[model samples]
Target: MTKPIYIHGSGCVSVQPTFEAGYFFDHVTSYTQNPVPALDPDYKAFIPALQLRRMNKSMRMAIFASRMAMQQAGITTVDAIITGSGLGCLRDSERFVEALRTDEGSLLNPTPFIQSTHNMAAAALALSLGCKGYNMTYVNNANSFESALLDAMIYLTEHPAATILLGGVDELGERTTQFWDLANYLKRDDATIPTPLIEQATPGEIATEGATFFVASQEPGDHTFGKIRAVETRLEVDAPEIFISGFLQRNGIEAETLDAVVLGYNGDSRYDEIYRTLGSSLFANLPQIAFKHVVGEYDTVVAAALFLALGIFQRQHVPQRLLLNHSSIPPILRRILIYTQRRGQNHSVILVEK
Candidate 1:
């Protein structure tokens, strides 16, 4: 059996004021743009101005969020750093590509090129923390965060004495957003935060960017937010409910036992039905919650869901903005199951408990 990995602390940087001290999902920051950008925290507080200027959005957010997690965990450094990104340093990548085309293969600026790789965020964390231990970055599309999380669990099980920083970071690119617009992957009309879900669902996602990080170890701490019981991801699932059931069975739990559930209802009509069906059948009696509408959708946005789960564990309350069902809130919130998918693919389920 996989051991539960304890989350000592977590931090997030998203469309909402997730970096704020007491910020939960209660007062979400709404956006009218389709591809909303993440709210920029005072980077000067966490990063040196000179170094911060040289970093791209991914590196900046990753380092800042990881630092927040470490601070909350009361640690100066971690033994290892592992992260995931669906699209790494996208802005830098776009810059490099544009430079290549504009310069006609001539010598080009190397800063963007050097920072464009998928592993740069993890590398940046390692450098910033002086961590020379195991470092990895997963780039498996929307499953990136789950992949990194599963690896973190395995690493902790093998190295019980080690503490690690695990997280996911992704940034928006100008050209990339334009491409998504052309591909009809983004909502152009009625694109607003607190996205109208289910009844007022739209056809495309509201693309955005952000990062979330956690300090984790094999042993539980007094200040531990929660424990990740299990995480599973499937590239394609014919029936999401069945896939979720199988995962729950493997973990020896059932839907009825869960205190609350987090569903990825991003307001896309074509794919929201998967969640709607599950809500009507399996999760009808539970407090169903959501986050993507406020944070917007990104390959690694599910990391924000995990952050929200930890927050729920701490507060033992479900904010009204996130609540999607009429079910009464459980007196004691524990054991939250988070299920998310992008366009009916990369379906993932994470079982969390306080």
Candidate 2:
């Protein structure tokens, strides 16, 4: 049997002012174009100038978010650290490749080369927190966050008393965006903010980046925000309704009992229908919410959805903006289901109970 895992605290750094003083969805940071970059936060508090100088944007976001989550959970340290990222440190990777291409691998600066790997983010977090046990990173396309989440669950179920600092982060890069733009993977310039979900939208998604960190543990405490009941990921999405039904049945949660279902509707007409199929049938009357329009979509953007669920469990409030289909808020939000897919692949479903 799967052991119960609860989230004590969470932190997010995203296109919105997530790392700021207020709830991110409340004072949203709007955008008009694709490939939006995360708002810069004051990193000096979590990182010293000397170390910050060498760290890339992705690393900074990870460290700051991890610190914020730890503080909120009222814990000084974690037994382990795990992170997930699709394109880890693209800025550094881009620079390193450019230098190698330009100079034919002659006298290239080692800074970018040293920081370009995918595991570097987890490495930086462990080094910063002085944690030396069971550190790992997962890079599984858009399933990255869910991959890390499942691993954390397995570890905690076995350890029973260990705490894990888990997170997902991705950064924007000039060259990377340019490549995406050429491939038409980004929404056109005319595409506006608050993406028109279920409405006519041109092909492509908003290329944005951010990080979400959580302090997950085996036992619930005073700081508990929500309990993660189950997490599942699929490399390919075959049957929409069947997949969701099976997932819910496995977790002993019925569709009618979910207070809310968070869907990743990123405004791509080609793929948004994947969510619509489920929203229209299984969750028609439920308080259906979509978030990519708020935070924008990245490989690990589902991590932001997890963060959103934690916020709702923490405050018992779901801001009106996130509601896709309007309805009076539930008297009490007890169960939430978060479902997301990356371009119709890497499908993930997570169950959270408050």
lDDT of each: 0.93, 0.89
Candidate 1 residue lDDT tens string, 190-271: 8999799999998999999999999999999988999999999999999888898899999999899999999999999999
Clashes of each: 0, 0
Model 2: per-residue Cα lDDT over 71-161, one tens digit each? 9999989999988999999999999999999999899999899999998989999999889999988999999999999998999988898
Candidate 1: pairs in clash: none
Instruction: Name the weakest run of 10 consecutive residues (lDDT summed) in model 2.
Output: 21-30
Where does candidate 1 stray beyond 4 Å? none
- What TM-score, over all chains together, does every model reach? 0.99, 0.97
